[model samples]
Structure formats: structure tokens, C-alpha cells
Target: MPQARRKTPFSGKAKKQQLQSKKQNKTLLMSTSSGTTSYDVVSVNYQPTRGRGGRDTNRYALKFYRETEEELKIKKEEALKELIPVPEKDLEVNPVDYFPADVSFPKRPPWDFNMTPAQLDAQEQRYFKNYIDSLQASEHWKKMSYFELNLETWRQLWRVLEMCDILLLIVDVRYAGMMFPPSLYSYIQAQKKDMILVLNKIDLVPSSVVAGWKQYLTTAYPALRVLYFTSCPAYNLRGVTSDKAGQSNEDFCETILEKADTSFYTHERYKSGVLSIGCVGQPNVGKSSLLNALMGRCVVSVSKTPGHTKHFQTIYLTPQVRLCDCPGLVFPSTVPRPIQILMGSYPIAQLREPYTTIRYLSERLDMPKLLRIEHPEGDDTWSPRDICDGWAKKKGYLTAKAARLDTYRAANSLLRMALDGRICLWLRPPGFAEHRDKYESCEEIKYIRWVQALTSDQEEQKSDVLTSESDDDRHSDDSDADDDSTDDSETAAIANKFAALAGDD
Candidate 1:
């Protein structure tokens, strides 16, 4: 203590000094008011858009946002505003009602072949910025869900547009109008590229609805060619007894090619050249699945995840016909987030507030009947949350810690079923309901119904065989042999039917 008192300069405590860290001002030498940033620097001779000569870095570069608390609050309010329940009249919705009443998609920016890749990229970026700015300036964008923000993905679309002879604009049958961009159709027309508006996942809707949609689209777009396609077409072949019911994978490819050939040969570029058909659409619309089905093998990976296809891939189906699978590009649209999620445009796992979607789904379908769960409160009243909770209880989806009903898991499971076509909410085209009988009796509808019946019969036969095996296990050996013979005959008959469907003699 005496030594400390003598040595005051070496005391444990020292006076603190106030200091300000220097704030570096980032130079805005390359500032622009166009709302897009350029990666080229005149002084350094480095261009990020051009990238390193051999290595590409722009394709996967996603534009990110830093939202302030105020911006986030505004978004929350907007989202709340969009969660309106489906009206009773909208159960069989007109495709036109869901879209913007008076708005058109932005056209691609003008570019010539003479432009460099860097210049083209920059132009596209600028065009996209203006497009977004225009949308933001208007109140219409709020009606739209999230779209692809990455420039690289759009670049892929641009490449596909320029390279392909025929464009296969795949769309979900449930919401075909929502997926079909008028601007895209116009662009293809201007480019003189033939387009086939493919209505995928036909199994989710009735054949009448499918035929009605096809009729409506063709009538609306007089020059456009529309075709119905489903990777799982087996679901459509169940009931009808037509030669087409036994149509195989080859017939599928041939049907597609026949459509393409009819259009391709009509074009000026159709001279004995390799036909390049570009498969393009919003994500999770079965573009990759269609390609895989056409190829008769898994040439490209497919997932329920939107944008699983990262880049455009070309696969030659025949020596003369090649199909290009473009990565799913979410075109700008006025479709709401809930519809987008329901249409499989958005990933279910990343859904934040799924209750809104549940409400939307509930409004359209009998939730209790669809989910096969009774109301938890022992009454007819069932809210979206109640439905989720009841379903969670029924499915034994519980929280790990509290053992509470996991409504989140239940809601996601319901959404997955909707996406996987287990829970269908069919949206019909305009005037479809008025002439429902006409559509149901159309040749196309009958064919689809036949396919459905055939596939359903096959499924039932398989189930019966499995049940017979399990139930008749204690039976005599003779009974087993008889069962085996019956099964073999049924299997052979099914094979022959499928062979006939495949256009086999």
C-alpha cells in the first residue's frame, strides 16, 4: 500500500481519452441514376460482367436486399392486405379474375448481334431495373408475388430465345393464365419463333377443365399452339377404353414432336436443319420432368423445388429433334403469393406464414373432407388455424418439447399435398362453368378420362394383388398358384394395353 501511494504514475487506473474512428467515404465515381450498377472500371481495365475469360461468375449471382425496419413493416402490412379469403363464387375461378386488370409485362430490351456480351448484360440489367422501377412506381406490383431477381437467369432466357426454333412455353394447368405472359408470347411472335403452350400436370384437374382451358387459350391467342402434357399421364388413362389409353412413352414423345414438326416445318428456318425446341416456363411447372419423360430417362435432375434446373441443357431426342431445358424463370406477374405457393411457384419449406395459404386453400376446397380430419372443437366451424391444428392432432404432428400440435408441420404437409397434386384446387378458364357439359363431353376430355380410367384400373389391380397376397397367405398352395396365374394374366393384359397405348400393333 505504501509502494502504491509512492508510485501514482503506475496506478492500476488510467484516464480514458475520447477518440473517434475515421469514417471512410466510399467514392461514388461511377454513380448512375439509372438504378443499375456497372462492374467495368476504366482505370483498372477489369470488367466483372465479362468475368474472367473462361470462368463464369454472373449466372448464379443473386441480387440481395437490405430492408430497413420501416420497409419491413410496410411489407408486412401489404402482405396482410393480400390475404383475403376466396369468395364462394371464386371456387371455380375465372383465370382472368386473378390477374391484373390493366397491366402488361415488360418486353425484352432491344439488342443486336453486334453487341458484346458485357454490353448485352449491362443493357439487360438496365432494362430489368427500369422494369422493376415501373412496377414499383405503380400499385400493381403489390398484387404480384416474388419473381426471379437474378440477371443470370434472365440471360439464360435471352439465350434460349435467340437460339431456339420452337419455344415450349410450359404452364401449370391449374393456373395457366397466370403463367402465360402476353409479352412473352408477343416476343416469340416478333422473333418468328413458334411456341407451344403446354398445359402440364393435367392429372390435377378434370379432363373437361383441361379441354376447356385448351379451348379458351387457343381462342384467345388465335395463332398460338396449345398442347396438354403431364409427366405422370398414367393418372389420365384410367377409365376409358381407347387405343390411346395404352399409349406408351414413345407415343408421348411422338405426339410432342408431331406438334413441333407441324410448327417447325412451317417456319422459314425449317429446312432439313436440327429442330431445337426450347422448354421454357416459370419454376416447378414440370419443365424438367417433361424433358426427362421425353428422353425416356433421367437426363436432367428434377425436384419439386423451383429453379432446380440451374442452366439451359440441350438433349437430342432424335438425330433431327433436340430439346433445350431452360432453368425455371419466374416471369413478372400479378398473381398473389398464396396462389404462387399453391401453384408450386414457391417452395413450401421456406414459407413463413402458411396460415394465409391454408385459408386460401380452405376457401376453395372442403378442408375437413380433403384432409379427412374432424374439427377439434366438435362443431362445424373450422378456421384455417383450427383445420391445421386438427390435422396436426390427427397426423400426430407434435412439438418435441411441449408436445403441442405442430400446426406448422401440418400446414406444410397440406401444402406439399397440394403441390404434389394430392389435393387439387382446379381453376377453370372463363365461361368454363357455363358450358361444363360441353367440355366434359369433348373428344379431348373423353381421351383424358379414358387414360385416367386405365391408370386407375392398373393401380387398383396392383393393390388387389398385394391385398390377396397378404390376406391369402394362410391359404393352400393350390390357391396361391391360382392367384399367381390370375395375377400373371392381369399383368400381361395390362402390359398389352399399355403396349397398345404406346402405338404398338
Candidate 2:
């Protein structure tokens, strides 16, 4: 330590310079070892071409001396790995975009009207010849089912519609408030063809309501010719049981025969030899049910679940009335998110509380009054459960344990009421009563209740006098002064006035 440190030749600046020299020498030695002479390597030059304004334009020139077979193979492999036809280095120009500046959009093909009277006689003769030739070549021709409204299905349906001789459009009266998809309806109208609008599920709604639905449809959709029908007629099933095979068979036969007789009277106009009827409607609107009822046999399977019918099935109803059952037509993806959630068709099932909708509908539709829920004290804040509990208590469904309300049973009772059509969710639009006097009437409600009772095996235990008294109490202030005097008139008149006061069912 006393000798003092001697100054070294490799100081801080010198050490850096020595390191940089070593790196350079190592690179040179490495290149030389690989037989790659720096002087033999080729160099590329970039140049710019002068324009009229003396501005230089960018361009590049590549110069190569020689490449080994291994290098060429490696380049080919690299190109193949990239899924390119050739190496990027070999490409001289960029691929041009093939998309046109003015691309023509697709248009709906025009309806083939070669057979229309407007065509020339010679053209008509030629069309007829071709038509007969095609028919002769085909194995068979059947009506298109309504289920083909999906994009893929619609194509096949359009083809069938083009070839068909007649189109029968079946509409549910219950869905009269919902508008038909314009594109589809317009296609039907463009055919300039006659369509028979079947007001199905008449047995579910009141006859007066059915009439109002029909009148509303007729006035709104003037292009469509409509007919009313209650596919299931009221039957006297006083002692019928599901276990009685023979009785059930007889009942089915009798029901069919009666329907056939009625059809002879009402559907006489559609008795032509080549009628093609296509049944369509929203899910669970009872499209398949009506078809099964009309067929008198299970030609198409019916289920309580909606969207069960996925394809169209065609059945012959006499040679003239060929019926085609389609999958229920729903607006492809236009169903409101909330409605879809409530209906349980949505994938996510966002519905946390369905009772909210039920309660709102109950209030808006005057459901408590419709079902005749009695609250002697005149309380207005009654919940849906309260109504259900009251109904259960009245119907004797009390629990034996704590004398608590049997709410689960009560809820079911409410569901049954809706299912039985005692509470109609859809109704005729406003101004309809003024233009058409076909608003729902009381006799119709009684008829619907009687039919529902027959089908569900639920007896009409509540006396008519009790129901009338309850109605009088509820609407006492609004009741007409001559109501008691009007009791002497026919039941139809009294029912009509009661229905008018009840609003649309």
C-alpha cells in the first residue's frame, strides 16, 4: 500500500476502445471462417426518379451476385410456411383489389306471372307446356309447410309457393294485435292470390272477442279474406274419463263428425279440389293444436311446449282441402328482449321476477275484476299472492298445519285461469268498439268458461247469482240505473252489456 498504485495502459477510455476493436475483429474473423468474403458480397442501391416538378419518386433496385441451392430451398420453405405462392422478396408488385367500385346489390326475384291472363296467348301456351312438362318430370308435388320461415327454410318455401296453385293463410284471432311481418305478407299479396285467414283458437276466446278480432283483421288487412272457426266445439263430457277408451273413442268420433258437418256449412267455398292451406302463427298460439283438432287424428304431434313443431307436415283433408302444418313463425330475431326473457326462450334467462309482468298485466287488464276476486273491505293494495290465496281459500285449498295460505296451490290456480282463457292477455285495439260492435260479450265468456271447464274437468262451482252480485258490488258506482230491470231480457243482451262494461277480453 505504501508503494502506491502504478498507472495502467488500459484506463477507462482505453478499455472501451480495446473492447470495440475486439468486437469488430471477432465479426470479421467469423465472416471469414464461413467463406463469406466481404469484398465478394453484393450491395443494393436505392434511387429516386425525378418528376416534372423535379421531385424525387421513391424506387428500389436489388442486386444479387449468386445464391446457393440451399439458400433457394430455404427461401422456398419459408414461403411455403407462410402459405404464400412465392417468396415476398421475389414479388415485384402488390395484388390488386378485385372488389368493384359500384357493386350491384341483390334484389328479390320478381314473381313468375307467366300463367297470368296479362301474358300473351302464345307465351301462356308455351308456359303451360313447360309447366306440364315439369309436373310430368316431378315425382310428386306437396304443399309447403309454415315452419320454413327461417332463412334456409324460406328459400324452399318460396320455391314451393312459386309452384303452388292455391295459398291458404291461417291466422290466430288471439294474435290480431301483433302485426304480420311485412316482407312475408307482402310476398303473399304480390301473388295476387286469394288467401283464407282462419281465425283459430276461437274456443279459447269469447265468441264476441273472436268476432271483434275477425272484424279488426278484415278492416286492417283488406287484402286477406278471413274466416272464423272454433276448432274445438263445446261438448257435454258429463261423465267422460281418460281411462274409458271406448267412450274416448266415441267422443273423438262424435266431435269429428260434428266438425265435419259444420265444415260442410261454413267452408263450402273452400271445397275446391286443389286447395292448399298453410297454417302459421306465433309459438304456443295453438297452431298445431288447431291442426290436430281439425285432422281429428294425431297427424302432427302436439305438445304443451312452444316451438316443438320444427318442420312442416302436410295432410290431406278431402282431395280439395290439403292442409299443411308449419313450424310456428316467429319474427326471426325481433322478439323484444324482455318478452323473450318472460317467455323463457332467451338463452341467458334474465328474468329474475316474472310476477312483475304478471302483476302489471293483472292491473292493466282488470284481472281482479275479470276473475271476480272478492275483497269485502275494498282493499286496493292486494298482491298477486293475496289474490291467489283468496282464490284458494274460496276454493278450499287451505293448509292443515298453521292455517297459513296455500300460496303454491294458489299460484297454480292463477296459471290455470290464464291458460283457460278466463283472462285474455291480448284484446281488440281502441276505436274497434265504435266501428265494430263485435266486442266480447258475457254469453261468450260463459261459453268459454264452460268449454274450459269441460276440457280441464274443473266444474263451474261458483253460482251465476254470486258472480253477478260480486260484479254489481265491484262496479256499483258505474252500474247503469236500469241494470236490475234489464234482467228480464234474454241472457244474450245481459251478457253483452256485462261484456261491454268488462272491456275487451
Candidate 3:
């Protein structure tokens, strides 16, 4: 007590610093405003635009780490004004309403019922603990989550997550955030496991946009690493062989492999240095394609169909690393069905009442222009039915009896078009803006740029050599011309000598 009476000089400063750190950790970077960040203004007036497109309602705002107390209060007031309270009984939105009426919603068993404590094996026991921990940690899971996984699906996922040292979370580059499950992310972190986020369909999005996503994802999940890849054009190169072209399917496939394989993964559990990486993602995220490319061959089944892998399978790549492919799990979606449909989780072929999804797509993308529907009359706005009928007629899809356009076929075709990357449905980063000039990338993207530079240097060298060879060909032609001229003079001299001899005779 006597010793404690002598207060440490720096104790107060240290405690203050500790408190600030804790406070800062809780604050999330929300949004930034270029217009006026001035906190002095007591009132915030948002003048709604009254022009074409109805006031630019889709304008995006940037989120910052923190805002002033006054700004926070203003935001709260605005939010409160906009928010209309609903009865507690009517709070829940039925997910089935978002989907087609024909489609039966996948039933979810009670979370605890799936794996009862008495029925749980040793492995199941571990997964149960992880699940409980994840639920406790994530408030979003508690409120919004609905597990679509059956017992078999849960068991497969549990096994994959349990066996693998690293998880390769593949997400469609267009809708990475939408597809990525927050519960799984929280679960992985809770288990202290490593995850490498693979932004799979990179070709569909611009490199700039990929960089933006990379930066944003890295910021959102600090524990996970990120990478970008696309196997479509690369994996599906028609007949281009290594002998014919230096950059063949083989080479492009290697680049794709390097993109994911090059991600840093290490764990102390693998004392033998052989690590298992589990590939997990929503169906149609190119999980099989990615695994095939990484393995340098099609070890797993590659298909256009989602949920192609019905069960979990492991293929050994090398002594150093192996890939564990689990069935493509569709996690509970809080998002609307249009988003789910667009994400490729829904079977495009079996889509009934595709009008809603068609409308959603039509609004975002200029469907009339894209589908080249020159109407009977000059009309800008077209209904889903109109667009479908127009597309059906253009594509030669007609009903047998009425000879009317088969709108169902046309709708399916349009959905496939978006999926096939003919018509892009790309999404930008959450923090994306048209006005922001400075492009920023994450550490992983910077690493990718470094790898790209190396590959580009090789191409540049080959081009330089070709240029030098062309220059040498020009020099050789000049020397040949000089030699021809010398030979002509010798021939002329010999002819003159012969003429003089003939005159003497």
C-alpha cells in the first residue's frame, strides 16, 4: 500500500491510451461526404431531386471510421424520421414471397435438432461448439439467419471445416459480398482458422473494380487474405495449344492456379507440412473450375449445374497441400430472391414466374438496348412481358398453338446471358463512387500486380526481340543490294573485254 502511494508518472497516460484504443476498436468506418462534412451545421436538409429518374435515389455515400457526435445525432434524427415502426408480430418478412410461387421454400430443421448432444459423435461435438460460439458472437446470425442446410449438408460442411487447416472461400466476383456468409466468417474466426477469399469470376469485372473489391474485403475481414481469378476464357480456350501459342490454355490455367496457390497459408497443426485447404462457396461460384485449374487437371467434376458435388471429396495435389471440395452450400439468405436468382443459386432452367427477376434486371441494365428490342412503336419504358415477348420473337422461341412468343424461354435465355458474361451484371465495391479519382488496392492486389509485372516483362522482352529481328532483316536487305550492284559492274567489265577481242580478230 505504501509502495502504491508513489504514483507512476506515466500511469495516467498509459491508461488513457488503452481506453482510446478500446473506443477506436468499437467504431466502424461508416461513410464519408465530399459535399460538406462540417459538424457545425445543426440541421441537415436533403433536397430531393425532381427530374428524370426520380431524384437520383441510387446515389452512393462513402463510410468513414467515425463521425462527430453532432453528425451522429443528425443521422439518428434523420433515420428516426424515415423509419416507420411495424408491429412486433408483423416484423418478419416471408422469404417465400420473394421467390416464385411454384418453388417450395427449402425447410430448415431446428438448429439444435440437426445435431443433438446425445447423437453427436466426437467430430459433431466439435462442430456444435463452433456453431454455438458463432451464433453467440454474431448478432446478425441471431436475428436474420435461417439455415437451409440439411443434416447431411451440415455434416459435410462440418467435416470439411474440421479437417482443413485453411478454407478457400470462393465468391463470384460480381456478388462477392452478397454470396459470402457472415455466420461462416464469424465461425471461422471463432475457431481461429485461416480463410483465403478467392474472388473467382474476375474476368466479368474490370481490374479497377476488382482492386476496389479487394481493398474493401480486406478491410472488412482483416483475418482473411484475398485473391482474384477467372477460369472462363482461360479454361475454355478453344484448341489453342502450348505449341501453337506461348500463352495457351495451359499457360492461362497456370496463372489461375498461381493466383490462388500463391496465397500464404501456414499452420502449426500440419507438422508434416501438408496442409488441407477446404473450398467452400455458394453454387456457381466456380468452385469446381477453380479446383480443376489449381490441380492442373479436372480431378473434380466441372459442370454448369450448381451443387454439382453432392458429397465432400478430397484430392491430393502435392505433398505440401491438398484440396477438400465440399458440396456448394447455399447459406441462409437475408437478401431478396432477385439477388439470390442473380447470384446463380436458383436453377435458371426451372425458373417459374421469372417476371420479378426480369424486372429487376431490366431496371438495372438497359434490357431493351441490350436485347436489341426495337419496339413496334417508339417506347422507352417496357414491361417485363413486353421485353420477354420481344426477346422470344427475336430468338425464334414461339408457342406451338398460338404462335405467340415463348416468354419463359426468353426469360431463361436472358438469365443465361447474364450468367455467361455476354451481358454483364457486375457490382462495384460498397464504397464505389464516380467522383473518387484515386484508385487504391489491398496488399493482396499489390502482390498480384507484382506477379503481373513479371509476366508482362516476359511479353515485353519477346516483343523487343521481334522488333530487333525486323531491324536486322532491313540491314541484311541493304547488304544484299550492294553485293548485287558489285556483281553487275564485274559482268559489265567482262563484256567490254570480250567486245575488244572480237574487234581485233
Candidate 4:
């Protein structure tokens, strides 16, 4: 009942296209009957070869089976798709091995020019040029930001770089990006040293915020590894004691705990060991606190003042590892000095005109609302000075001479509030979610309070703004509907209302 299929020869058009494609390579390049080379023609003053033309003409007429041009092209495209090239795939995107897209160093610092200055200078010029050119060509260059070079202070940092095997770049979680110096990152990388970004004050922000920052940093710097820490551990919190981390820190804010033990596996630098890990960061970023946290006691002096540690020292962690504790330095930044002062990088007291900074802070933070200062003139508007004056009058901060409210004293108090985290102005690393993850599932006693606060802030910010139209609709609904009508399922509304009341109590 079955009929056998008959084989059919390829179409002539396909066969002809195939032969033409192969004519140059698989098919020999035929010559005309004369067999004259180009060299021979050149000797005779441009005599043409007739033999090449005749042989080619005969070869074109010969029949040959070959792959079609379209078929070959399709095969080539398929091959290319399978073999698409990309930058090397990094399997271990972890805290481990990675080749450096290393920031090459300045040939020689001006202070320490030992050899031919001209030679080093020339090399430096060339290296910087190449660095810029390469960056210009790369599509990823848009993601990078520029830095204000503070060459002088980094001298100490440079010395520290030479001495350490692993560099711990400590950053305060509240101001992680501000404290993280791209220049220092370049410098450490230039020295071919291993660096870990240690995010201190972990108890300040939520776990999801921490996770997002970790993810963001890891994305930007593929090799960057992160570890979270807090100087004020759950056990160390003074006066207010809760045998858990999640409840107490948020309840009492992240203030220092008096005379309490705190410990972590993080090491400090200096001394000869199998590995030398150094602690470095902007001042008040908890470099000294980090050391104390690791030691479980106050081995190193800790202060709110920046650069409290003035000298290089060592804290022996173990026989295998040593910590190099270097004094924190105020690195170069293009960010305004007032912002730096607000960031606690520069001393707030060392300023001449603080009015500009006060103005800057007021504009963003709704200072009047925060300070509960109202204008005496009975207007909605108030200048920074006016707000300061109102605050001064409220607090009875009188200038002794004129008996007027002391505006300067009020300003200082505002700055103190910001520094102490009362005002709650903070910078999160980029790509952080607007809606922080509900970390209620995280039952870690030490982390619960922060989670609660983070979630509460997010939820409050997410509430829908009631417009005039929406308010009218709500009123109409109230009049039209039954008084005991269910609002979002009866059980959920009751539970939510009850929870809110309990929280207030």
C-alpha cells in the first residue's frame, strides 16, 4: 500500500549559485591560454593577460555540486549566534578571586619624586591620557562619577596602602555613598591590594536597604564584597536594655551603649602576620568603633569628633591576622563644604558663615515643621534666620547684650539634631527600593526594631493623598451607604485598627 519516494536533483539556479560562490576557493582560479603573470606584464609596459580570461570563462561553464550561497550564509549566521562574544563571565561574583580592572597609580607624587622627575611626569601624562581615552570609548563610562582630588590628605592613606594586605574601607550606612571615596578605590586598586567595603552602623537602616546597597555596590564594582556591622550592638545598648537587637536599637535609636561588650570577627591592621588588614574611612565613620567592636572592648579611643585617631597603630587580632588602625582622613570631594559639615566629614564649628548651610538644610528638611517654630509675623513664610529666631525665642536662647533670641545657638541645636539622627536625613545607595521589603519574617531579636521602623516609614509614605474630588466621593459614599458597612474586609479593618491603637498605647 506504500509508494517509494523518488530522489530529485537540486534546481539549476541553486547549483549555479553554489558553484559561483565556490569558484574562487574550492574551484581553482583558472588562467587564460597565454598564462601571463602580472609581473611579466609590468616588465613589458602594461601588457594584459588573455590566458587568465579564457581559463576563467571555461571554468564558469563547468558543472559542480556545492552548498548554495543562501544556505552557507544561514549556517554562518547560526554559528555566529551560538558564539556571541561578551566580557568574561565571572562565576564567583563573591568575596573571592577576581582580576583587577585596576586603577593605575600616578607615576610619582610630587613630594616623593626620587628619580628623573621629567621621565615620571611624562609617563604620568601618558598613563592618564590613555586612561581617559579608554574610558571615553567604553559605553559603561556614563555610570561613573567624577571626584574632587584631595592629594595632600591621601599621603597618609597611601602609606597605609603600602603596609596592608587587605584594606577594609569602612562606610557609615546612613552616608554610605558619601563616605565611599572613588579616588581611594582607585588608589587601593592601583596598589594591587585587596579591599572589602565594610558597611558599619548596620543597625541604622533596614535589612532590605542593606541588601539593596549590597546588590548595587556589587553591580557597580563586580568584585566588591560587603559585610554589615553596627558599633552599638544589642548587648551594648545602655540604660534601655532588651535582650534582643531588633526591639532595643529602634526603640532607643543607635546611640552608643555605655560600658557594654560588643564583638565581631572583623580584624584590624598593623604588625607582621599571615595577612595584614587595615581599617580606613572618612572620620566619624566608626574606624575606631569597628576596632572596639572586634575586640569586644574599647582597646582604641572612640569619639564623635572626626580624625580622633591621629597616629598609625596596630591591634593584634590573632597570630594569623593583624589590624592596621590608621587615623581617618577627610578625602577630597567636590561636594560643598556645608554638605561635608552636615555629613560630619568637616568640623561644624570651624566655619565662618553658617547661614548658607542653615539655609541649605532648611530648604530640604522642612525645618519649621521639625523645630515647631512659627513666624511671629503670622505668615506661612519664614527665612532661615526667622526660623532660627523663632526657635531661639521658643527655647529662651537669648543674646545677653540685646536680649534678642540667639539665632546662632538655635542653628547649632538644629545641626546637633541632624547629627544625632533626630531629623532622620540619610543617603541610601542607588537603586534602593522605594518600598523597603517587609523584614517581619526576619525574627532576629537585634534587627526587629530597625525593620519595624523601616517598614512603618515606607507604609506611611505610601498612603494615597486625598484630593478634593476623592474627599467628596468619600462623603457621598458615607451618606449613600450603611453606617456599619465593611471597610476593606471587616476582620482586616478591625485587626488593623486594633494594631494601630495598641501601637499608640
- Best model per lDDT: 1
Better model by TM-score: candidate 1 vs candidate 4: 1
Off by over 4 Å in 1: 1-58, 61-88, 92-107, 233-272, 450-505
For model 3, state the Cα shift of residue 491 in Å: 62
In order, candidate lDDTs are: 0.60, 0.39, 0.52, 0.48
| lDDT computed for candidate 4 | 0.48
All candidates in order of lDDT, best leading: 1, 3, 4, 2
lDDT, candidate 4, 407-465, per-residue tens: 77666666655554444455545434332453223344224334233344543442221
Cα lDDT of model 2 by residue, 1-505, tens digit: 4997785344465456345434332332112335644321121222333333332211111111223456446543432121112222221111011111121111123334444433433343344334323432333211101111122223223333443445555544544443244344555667665556666555444455555555555676687676654443221122111221112343343323211010001223244656766665555555655565555543454543444554455566666666655544343322222233222222111122234334434543554555555642356556555555555555455566987766555554454344334444444443544544435443444445433332222223321211222232221233342234433332211122122222323
lDDT of 2 at 374: 68
Point out the worst 10-residue segment of candidate 2 by lDDT. Answer: 257-266
- Against the true structure, candidate 4 reaches a TM-score of 0.53
Please write out the lDDT profile of model 1 over residues 1-505, one tens digit for every residue: 4555453242122111001000101111123458634321111111243333333333333222222356446554443232244654465554455445455554457666677766865676667666656665666644655666555566667666666899999999888877887777777888877889988876556667788888888887787998776665332233222222223444444333211110111234644788888889987898866776665554565667666666676677888888877778766666777788888766677665687778778777777764457877787667777888877776666788998988888788778777765566767677776888898677786566454334535433432111111222222222332223333322212222233345522
lDDT of 3: 0.52
Q: Cα deviation of 444 in candidate 2 (Å)?
A: 15
Candidate 3: segments with Cα more than 4 A from true spot: 1-118, 121-147, 233-268, 376-378, 434-436, 440-505
Candidate 1 backbone overlaps, count: 21
Pairwise TM-score winner, candidates 2 and 4: 4
